[model samples]
Target chain A: MGISGAAFIAGAYEHPLRVIPDKSVAQVHAEVAAGALADAGLSFSDVDGYFCAGDAPGMGGIGMADYMGLKLKHTDSTETGGSSYLVHVGHAMEAIHAGKIKVALVTLAGLPRQASANLQMGVTDTPEGGFENVFGPTIHGMYALAAKRHMHEYGTTSEQLAWIRVAASTHAQYNPNAMFQNVVTVEDVINSPMVSDPLHRLDCCVISDGGGAVVIVSPDVAKGLERHSIKVLGHGEAPKHSDNGKIDLTYTGAAWSGPAAFDEAKLTPKDIQYASIYDSFTITVLEQIEDLGFCEKGKGGEFVADGGLISPTGRLPFNTDGGGLTNNHPVNRGGMTKILEAVRQLRGEAHPAVQVPNCELALAHGTGGSIGTRMGSATLVLGRD
Target chain B: MTEATAPVMPAPAPIVNPENKPFWDATVEGRLVLPKCQNCGSINWYPRVFCPECGKFGVDWIDAAGTGTIYTFAITRRGMGAYGKAGPYVLAYVELDEGPRIMTNIVDCDVDSINIGDKVRVVFHDTGSGSALPRFTPVS
Candidate 1:
């Protein structure tokens, strides 16, 4: 009755450019779409379902469907910030499970680095804008609030948080397209200038102008494909908001989403061979690791320390493609890259230096919106056939 | 030597809406009011018209105790847009005595001295455009 084995991710393509100054956002989206379709040994005309998020140019899914000339029978324009693509992947699986479409195409693209000023200044008028807008909470400021609260409540230190950036850098060394390639030490992270209290500049992800696309197909459609397909084992999504005034900064929506996903997959955290966690900030990785049941609630600091997240030797080798922390957070949306890496690992297509020996099961988790405020979280479990 | 008094960034005028108009209106008179559900009696922040708990209308704006304690805070060293020039400001949420926590800036104190559970009281800052924004200052 579940989506397990109902759909397969046939192809994934991450646009190589970290900064695309010459190309438009829609152009990047189209390029990645073509690349993924070609990799899957399918044509653009084969795609019957289109999935995108706020990053897509024009009117999201509908607009992109037209731009890509995709004759889609189904489309989803679910906007969940950076986690939109992960959520879209889950939604695509449900559609395939229900026999709505055969070949589903999911894409994300943005130029946040080029439009940094406008993106930061742009504020939508929501019901809560009146109360929050007047406080001038920047993106860094919002995440810093959560980081400070976690440190206060759990005794998480800046040195421990620095290790996340270190782990990411360690893997980024092998990624030719990574925005940061040099391995950084704990001292480098600790000594970096603080953008917000407790969160150093290195703790933040690089803003890039790139895009990625994934081709998901029904199990029936996969029989005709030549590329190795990764099975959709389980998916879960949830939201965590400030409960009136009672807000707990110690945990994330992953606490709910991760377990729901594992339950459906009939697996535990121990079974996950790889994880592609959203890394918008160091505190994000630390908190999600705890919430994902990788370790005890307050023991993420110890779990992530001493080269624990480094590839080959770590208990769970994560973000082998360097992840958003060191590679690219295209258009500031990281959900797309999370899935791309997990697919790479499951297909044994990752760089040999950082790839898990036999990555059987992988988990990719994404948190959309600000961690200090309300957010949509999505978790996906994928496996090799 | 704390530069906590560094420049107070004038907040961009809030987009006042019907759901939160009364809450902003009360701040002009230097009074803090919270929406209390007439059905469940549970209070909520952001002054919503309907009760988030009981799902009923006819909520009342009750006067709130202006005093609270710092639940959490971060000293933002860098800011964007209008806050770009305002250096080293303490952005925080204070758990009000009335039980609802509110997001506000903690002014008139050393940034390094502010900690979770520190007592604070609300102070109204006139926005020069008919409404006032409620900020907090250390109780001590």
Candidate 2:
């Protein structure tokens, strides 16, 4: 299984205070789909499989298939919050390996800014609303709980967490489309308004309107194609119990998914040349770095405190596109962007400033939902062939 | 025209579905109850029909000792949506003496003074909807 083509597109609106308010999620998806197909030198007529996170009224894949006039042979609409697309990539790879589909397309798009006026994906009044939502804990607040616990249990400091934001903004300086490019210091991140305890405003990701698409094909189909392809060496996914009563807030599903992915890829954390771990929050990157076996458990703070590990010129470059913290969150769905950056890094087409020299293997990981409660994790190992 | 009014804070109300009705009902009487399994003695929170550990439906509601310790907590300086108007509050996970950790808000004290592993006891607050929601406050 290999990704033959990929495309990332943002709505033509870039105002710091206001949204573009022009394109719908479907419109963004359609454009990204067409662009990705064109990049693959293929057309909608050639797509046999469709996959997407079901964030819209109807299932996203079915709606996309109808909108693009593609008669798909397979469709996957997995909803695992931000990590849904990475999980989709794993599913698409399995289906393609089984000869179920020749060319599979996975797409994601969201318009969080226009959600108020447009068809918003409003939170439904579910059962958990009574238990969890009643207390008014913002999404950041939930993750803050994890950060507090991690600090309490492992002696992690706010300064260490602030460094992740600083690193992200540093990378964003090279990205023209990033939401925030201004370099920030640890003191600046600490001085920022507190959204929740243990997390400053800069510690969280920004909301943006964007979409991305990736075209996956069987190895044979990729071999026949003219464009360069990146092999999907391995992938794994895991779901955590959503009920806060049962979940251990300090740990996440990545503890399971990361090991599974590494085993399947037959590679250790040392083999990775580039990394694209999700950055919905600074603590998220810390947790994943530890759970992915890059460092010892509870040692992520020390591992990331120094700028060299994740800096572009360092041993392991991560989130080269600035990540969600400084780049874009796309309605809190970061898996697509994570995959897009990994592909770009492998193709040697990443932003010149953040490009890892002689990069060959890249790892992209994603986390969805609240880390303090129920969360989903997905890991993918991609390699240049 | 006139200035826009601030949004109303959302009331703390629990959605009492059929599976979790008994738990909410007990909350109204200032009692905390959990589903205890007859087959394996495993206690379940958030209401489940079958025991998670034993996979049996022989689960019964049992009273809980309202004492626990703060497993972790966050002081929300700025809330979101309706909660935005609610002001700073403490959101935390309290690990009950009986074994399950529950999501709750710590109340009746300064939010910044709370610490992990502090002993806490449950206190019921009226939702103004005839139902009460359980919160925790530090115990001396």
Candidate 3:
């Protein structure tokens, strides 16, 4: 299985906060779907499978299929926060190999910044609300709890966390569509207003209104397409404890998913040329780097602090699209964007500023839900064919 | 001449349902209760219908010691909605002596001075709805 076309759609604004009042969530999804299909030189009729996430008015995937007029043979509406789309890629691959569907279109869109509507997923009625929300732990506070614990257990410094933001911002400088293009230093990130203990305001991902779509096809279908296709080498997904279940706050589902992905891909971390790990928070990237076997446990802070590890010319160029830290978050469905960037990198079409030279293999990883409580993770390995 | 009065603090109220009614009822009396699986001796948090460890329905409520250590914490300088007005508060997970980490708010201590592994004891704050919310304060 391979990805034939990838397209991202959002308002043209460089400011960190802007609302696209005119466009609804469905409108954005339709635009991105058309663009992606066109990129692959295919039409709507060519798509036989549909996958989507996020809370819309009705059933997630059914709503999108109705709005886009996509009559599909297979559908998946898996909702696991930001990592939903990455998991979709794995599901699509399995289904294609089994002859369940020939062409699958995975789409994601949200309007969090729009004043006219609220598209963020509702969490008040969830089990997390019953157990954790009573104490007033904001999403940032939850991730901050992990950061503080990491600092306490591993002697990680706030300076090292700031470096993660610095690396993402540096990559954002080349992405004209990124929310924040100004390069910031470690001091700037550390001195920014504290949203929660150990997490500065700059440590959080920017909220934005955007959407993205990707077209996946079986090898035979991909062979017929004129566009270049990126091979889906292997993938894995895992769910940690439930909302109220006991969890090791330092470890994430990535610990299981990452190794499973690498094993199936038959490749080690050393073979990866580029990475597009989720960046809902700086600690997220740091945790995934260590959990994905890029570094030893508790050595993530030191590994990331090393000069240019995440830079364009560094040992592992990651989040080349600026990531959620600076780029658009689009209702925290960043896994979709992560996949989009990995496809671009393998296609040799990434922006020259953040492109890794001679890039052959790339990894896309996503973490969803609160870090302190329960969450899910998905990892994918893609290669140029 | 008129005088202005202080506004009432706005905090989210805990949702009490059929599955968790007993847990909340016990808190009103200033006792912390958790579900314990008699089959496997595994303590469960968040109140589940069955034992997550043993997958048995022989779970029973047991009184906890109310003493624990801070596993992790965050000082929230900004909050959502009414919580925003109550800035610089400590939100933390306290690992109970019974072997379960529970989410709580740490009170009666400097938010900046709190550290992981700090000993804490449970304290109840009245929610004005006849139910007391369980919070933790450093055990000096």
Candidate 4:
């Protein structure tokens, strides 16, 4: 029961800003900021805080904020691989609670502009007593391990795992901004080249260059800012890490956190009419729903096989706009899509083809770390009061 | 003085703490041993003093049967760091005949020979130093 103002925008990078630039950072930030402000029906001055996920070149949160011609009251350049933006929202909400700031503009830009075969990118600074990446983990291989673990435990067959791709493509076919909108079936997912064992090429989300932003203000700030407020009903977070020892590759904390958060927000799975789960891999989403109590743990494999969500009328309309698996994965842009879709449903602005009836409350969940051994999850429950 | 760019990670070194010495020692000795709860008799790897099941610190090292099954594996295309040059090698999880899984390399066979649930017999290879790494091979 908290936040108020929120809007989102997405656009292809490497366009328009060619010659006079440092990798099109500023121009890209402005385009997204404008889109967000426009969606919320506000101007730039209303944004006093900034949160960003990308650290490409010399750009961080305040670095981009200053160039956007605004003095940021609060900022976070929090980067934890892919789940940064979703995690940032939890941080921003905490700041809002402190009453130190209002109105934050969050943005992300991870674009691969023409691939080169160079190994060394810029080195990263270790955070204060943060765990090191000594395990030599890749995001892809970790997801493969998770798929295998889920298969080992739940009797979740590889064929059932491929169904996630089928469901995602079916929805993305109606979404133009989606990178791979071609409609495909389960056979396509199975026949696809193996990227990691048990995880085929279609199992992984695409890597695309894009930017997205969302503007959120506190309830007090929202009264004067806009006519409608999609109140943040609840937020929850859980992390998997320890400076010492064995990585247990089972049991997602979200299974516990989802119920805990719903209890706090005074909501239930049934009340959530539409959901946008981070789909870095098809199997991850199935695990999240099972663990989050959308369905029983072993039952998820069957849920997907039964065509649980190919159309709006399906049991639970999930990732209504193509998810990261099919849609544009601007990294942080993935989180923005969910926040934007929730606001659209609350405002009844979702394209009629995939709109839900009375989608009052929405759920957006995000998790990161390639190997499921180290997992971080944040769930957002928002509603139209 | 200027603020210097910081290192993203600490130097990668083999980890050793008070509780893990036995497990590390066994790896160097070419013996696969896991701590079994002497009180409740539960077997587990990556050794610990306290038994997870019985909440007792009576667990002690026992030599495990080297035999296991290839629960799952991947012929890694992208090798990592020093290991990257050893590309297209199989990294597998072996579910031991004694009821525990350990992540180890699967060798002594071609890529086409490995499949899920295939029987594996363990062999230990020395690093020419005091240490050896336990790896498994597909059972004929």
Candidate 5:
């Protein structure tokens, strides 16, 4: 019972708005769900399984299901921060394979920009919170720690990490819906305000308010759809934590999840023509590109240097939708958008300027939570067969 | 080396729980203690009841030398939430002599001069609660 060919991502939709001040989070969820189902040539009535993450309002999947009028036989509200949607895709594939349901709808939405004033460090009365919250570890600070360590150990320079943002911005030029459509240079990133050591403001993803959805279906239901569906080739997820004070900031959970995904897909990193590497920050992409076996562990700097990740001319084209970097990081969760871009690439519907030619096999990887502390990482392999 | 006075930081009182009360109790007395698994003889940080290594329920508190080298650090120019105004601080992990690293702040020194492998010793910042948060300063 593998995910390979077990399910198809028949529908994918991304909200055109990067800022949705007027709409409620629940409304965005419903809108994306409808867009995805409509893309699949189906309607909300066809969805029998609903999947969501912490981004969902109220009781998670239960609340969204009721709001959307989704009569479901099965539902999942697994929350993994940013990577929740990728996890949902995997869970949906398993459910479909088990014959639990024929069609599953996964939705994600957030308005962090609108909620920015109220954003807190998220310290609370949890098990690890008492110990960690006192020190004041912001999201930027967490990734900055990893970046600093990676540089100290591997001689990774801030310039090398800058290439990732450059690549994202380069592709973003053609994405009309992207928040930042202007192409930037390495010098630009290096000169940007330092929010945290080794991480400039441009190195981080844009905060926006929007949502996206993907409709996954069993092979039987997929064959009846009017649009071509991307095959679910493989899936993997893993959690990386501080190992009881023996924390290693040099790597991420991608080291475990990426291999598990590639092995299940019976493919190698070299086989992937396009990738949707989550871009919470520039260092985020560099580390995942290394851990995903695209390059050696400490060789990420060289791997991404000199247009390595730029589309068409680059070695590995990634985040053609501008990713969370230049595009939008809705709700501060990027997993859903990662899957949407991969689906677009496999279907050859990505922006022509950044779309990989003859693109057949693509991989999308997402990291939820902080890479500096604990994180939930998920990887997926999708193909057009 | 000790700071002439306690460095000013937004040291919030840790939410005390049953599992970590002993560790905080030691801090209030101006000491750093770690949980040592009696079954495996492995020392763990954060004072967990069970050993993460051997999965043993029995453990003992061991006083630490409270001196370690910096593992990694980042200077946050803009902090988070309540820490939003507390910028230009060094957030670091200090690898203690007890074979475990603890997340802490490296204070009372130039933030720009802090680096990995710099030796540091522990100092306490009273959180207005009974317990004090253990931080580190560069070994001059």
Candidate 6:
């Protein structure tokens, strides 16, 4: 049978993850968790299984285990690419299946803003300790490579790429925490000094220091918890590469994850009222839209054009929090923000500036891994019912 | 894969991810390669030892056409770390004629004149490691 779950009380910490200066990853988690518990009207005692998706190796589940003094009934410190927290839901569900506990906590944080983040050149971790670093392939360069490939194949325009930045910037206007709220046009995106070939500084995701957390309680326990509960509904995942590139860059494995999730949730692209997609980059969302069965594969660029995904007139709005591009990307906490916004919309608490009315259903998807190959994607659907 | 240059860096040692040994070998020798899964007939990337689509282990390496088009690109005005000297370079995504798009750098032409869908062919840019890095050049 397909995976099924009950009511969940979730929390989202949207503070400028880069806001705090000198906060350790652990401090970020503790602060985010405390804020999350307060928002959920619950205390640390209510949490049983601890999960931390923070990028730093030491601060995942073990970090939380040390912090809250959790007995560690069932803990998952899954450090998959960026969509890791979404993957946490999958692990948490398995723990529940194993009868480990009734409540679970997931958190993410980093120091991109404080300049404490190790952003000397490329990716956060270089192929596990400089293995790939010496290759001269930084994360931005890899992504820059992918972006150029996407453009060449589909005849996608830099203007088209700018469309994503424009959409995000427009969305950021309402989100005070968003760093670049000032309106930036397509010309601005194109003119921005290039960081790598085909990738401008604006095209790349900024490294910032920030943290966010979410709590998941069983249906039975969730009923007594504060705030309107959102059921897990369904979760699914797939990978094109685990440690190395394994498949064609165009066709993706995320499509496999999306269909299973939609089938499990009994929902479709049209069924969703809004979507909070992971936005590490504009192209990441473009490819996921293709892979997630939202639109035909190559047609993604066209589908998103002409105010489609970027246009407010489009049916399904995305990345309600300005996404990783404009918002804080504290080690893929960008993905966590997607879930956080989904929870708020389900509870009818979205920012008044960009809230979708009667937002009963939503989609949150992520691609975690290097830009070129060996990607991981997770699809999740949330419903108010 | 090769010697360290101003932009491209050399591997401190050889890469050994299991599936991509051949790709690295070819890189050290200055050739671009990809993988075709035996079970699912899928062409995949990053040189995996197993098939990602069918979960089958019967996969082998194959060389690409070395011909493709520019999909998108960024002309770097700034560089970081060891690459700090490479302020104005074109990091490109090239769509191979065989249907897969690869992340690579574009060379041998003015970065401004390059646009999406422009024809490109593979060329070797020495990494100074002893082998040259595979880069794409606009086909005249």
Count of backbone collisions within predicted model 1: 0
Better of 1 and 5 by TM-score: 1
Ranking by TM-score: 1, 5, 3, 2, 6, 4
Off by over 4 Å in 4: A1-22, A25-27, A54-60, A116-137, A241-250, B1-72, B75-88, B94-102, B110-134, B138-140
lDDT, model 1 = 0.88
In model 1, the runs with Cα more than 4 Å from the true position are A118-121
lDDT of 2 by residue, A168-228 (tens): 8889898888889998998999999888879999999988877778888877777777877
Q: Write the per-residue lDDT of candidate 6 for residues A1-385, one digit (tens) a residue.
A: 5666653645555555456666676777778878887777777877888886546447457756776666667778776667788888766766766667777888877665555443334434333322234434566666666666666677766677677777777777887787667767878988987666566667666566676777777777767766777877878888765233323455555778788788878878878877777777676777777778778777777776655654235645777677778876776446677788788778887777677778888878777776564567787887785
The docking quality of candidate 6, as DockQ, is 0.31
Judge candidate 4 at residue B44 and give its lDDT: 61
Report the C-alpha lDDT of model 5 over A1-385, residue by residue, as the tens digit: 3557799999999999987889888999999999999999999999999999988998868998889898999999998889999999999999999999999999998777676544345667777787777888888888898999999999999999999999999999999999999999999999999988879999999888998999999999998888999998999999999898889988888999998888889999999999999899999999999999999899999989999999978989999989999997888889999999999999989988888998999999999999888899999999997
Residue A180 of model 5, lDDT score = 96
Q: What is the lDDT of residue A105 in candidate 5?
A: 98
lDDT of 3 by residue, B61-127 (tens): 8999999999999887766654757756788889899888888888877665677999999988767
What digit string (tens of lDDT, one per residue) describes model 5 on residues B89-124? Answer: 788888998888888888898776778999999999
- In model 5, pairs of residues that clash are A110-A331
Top of the candidates by TM-score: 1
What does the lDDT come to for candidate 5? Answer: 0.89
Give the higher-lDDT candidate: 1 or 4. 1
Candidate 4 residue pairs in clash (backbone atoms < 3 Å)? A1-A233, A142-A370, B79-B84
All candidates' TM-scores? Answer: 0.98, 0.92, 0.93, 0.77, 0.97, 0.81
* Candidate 3 lDDT by residue in tens digits, A1-385: 2332221111111222334678777877777788788888788888899888764435868888888888899998888889998898888887887788888888877777765332222337565466677677788888998998989888989999898888989888888888898889999999999888789988889888877788888888888878887888878899887434455777788999998888777888989999998999999888989999888899988888854555566757898888899988876667888888888888887888878887888899998887777788999988887
What do the candidate models score in CA lDDT, each in turn? Answer: 0.88, 0.79, 0.79, 0.65, 0.89, 0.68
Error of 5 at A267 (Å): 0.6
User: What is the Cα-based lDDT of residue A179 in candidate 5?
Assistant: 97
Cα DockQ of the candidate 5 complex = 0.69
Q: Compute the lDDT for candidate 6.
A: 0.68
